[model samples]
Target: MTYHRITSIDDRYFKPFHQLLQTIFPPEEVLEYELWREPIQDPAIYVYAALDGEEVVGATEYRYYKELRVAMTDFTIIGKASMGIGRFLMRNREQHLEQIMKDSGTVSLGMFAEIYDPYRAGIHSFGGVSPMNPIVRREVLSHMGYKRLELTYVHPSWDHEGAAVSELDLCFLPQNEELSELPALLIVSFLTGYYEALPNKPEAWHAMIEQLKTKETVKLAPL
Candidate 1:
């Protein structure tokens, strides 16, 4: 398996990356190909893909907040399970972010992800309901040291005008005390046994967390 950062949509891995997304999300939930391609071009966005001999099996995208020093996982999809591709892509993204911090003389307080609530199903246009399947993705994330922070918020739906029914869970790793004041259920993982649960913890995992702690604390915008 090979893992690399995607800098451009034309970077040879674009087609498979696009296909992987199409295969995962429903038609209405997926963005138009052109529209989706735009974010990958933005320098602030980081896209990583996992390939098994040239076939893109998994892809993860993140948006970096320079001022906040936070990297948010915007979306991640894995075409196959139990291959360990998801974990590979996540660790790669974290390493990439760490390098960015080192180059900029900043520190990343934590990595975060917002996922649709797996328990709920959305109403479909054909009168049938479409269930949200975030279980597999959530499991992979939890194993990677990300704890589910009790920050639940309703994300307004784009498909249904003026309706905000999508509930999302906000999760983060190496929790900070400052985050607890933000009116969210903050869960932190004690690195001890958690790493043992992972298939293989990245060599830099512990060092990276220590480096992150030395940086300035993340300031939360008033809620």
Candidate 2:
């Protein structure tokens, strides 16, 4: 399999990569094609594809907030399961993000991702098909060293049209082992940068940050 950092929306693999996301993720979670095109044009956003010959087997997307010294994993999907494709893609993406931080003369804090809470939202399905079981998904992520943050996570709607997603868990993986507990300020900074970049701010945005401010640190638990 060949790994590629897809830089342009016009790339032949872009459409297929996005199609994979549509097939796996629910419509509410997947951004509109044009909306994605805008972010892909930005320097902070990174999109990658894992291909077997000409077919896209896996894909991942991320956004690096330079000022906050942190990044967010926006989307990741493996078209062919249990082939180690997801691990390979994530490994490559992390290395790339690290390089970006190094080149900018800054240290990375951590990476965060919003995952569905199986207990609250049962199994996530699209068109009657469950692409990845939520329970098993957490196990896979746990194996990769990601931990669930001990806080109520509400996924903000960037478009302002969709309702805020509360049935999700915010998982995090720090840059190094020395960074044990997640600082509340870091989470606040990351969220601030995240919401600022988007056009529409979720109504709960301010309250969420305030909620984090009340705590000294956010505890991380095994996924």
Candidate 3:
């Protein structure tokens, strides 16, 4: 199998990625995004796509957040893919990251991931799914312990054809609640499965990021 990693959404192959996401979600619901990246000695985020021929058969996204520096995370996947690819990429990147955290005495893989099974109805993967990512599902927030978290929802507005073209900032605050991290919400939203959004559903994802944060408290020495 041939695997491709995307650092910039503007890459020629990224067109396929956009097509996949746009096809899955209505124009309004889907995010019109750009893949802007900066050069880093050790890359933190990677979007992997595998192709049998020239078509994208499987894909997954991963990241290494500042807070959870030790462990690398891969959660979101599109098309027919599995945990193995995700795990492979993460494990490969973890070697360097884990060592850094160990030297700093902040061991224990600090991966922020919710279990998922991709074969399920929607957005489920690996083990399970995160219910209603920040902007993905709004009504299900309070039930899952997530506060309104300030202005975080973007309402997708459709064009005359109703095919969905652009999005407008819709202030969706459940109630008076404190805001979480500032800029990290977008990055955190990725880990929360915000990309797999569907309209008019109870919950595309049954799982939600609740009690856990770090991949591990202390990194155990490699055997």
Q: Roughly what TM-score does model 3 have, to 2 decimal places?
A: 0.39
Whichever of 1 and 2 has more TM-score, that candidate is 2
lDDT of 2 at 112: 91
Residue 146 miss distance in model 3 (angstroms): 18
Error of 3 at 68 (Å): 3.5
Better of 1 and 2 by lDDT: 2
Give the distance in Å from residue 62's predicted Cα in candidate 3 to where it truly belongs: 1.4
Over 48-104, each residue of candidate 3 has an lDDT whose tens digit, in order, gives 666556776445555544443323333334344443543444344456455656566
lDDT of 2 by residue, 1-223 (tens): 7888787778899899878778877666777776766767777777888999899988888987778877899877778766788778878987888789888888877789887778897657633323366776667777777888898777666445636778778888777855567889988877777766555655675677789999999988877
Top model number, lDDT: 2
Task: Flag the better candidate by TM-score, 1 or 3.
Answer: 1
Winner on TM-score between 2 and 3 is: 2
Candidate 2 stretches greater than 4 Å from native: 126-131, 158-162
Global local distance difference test of model 2: 0.77
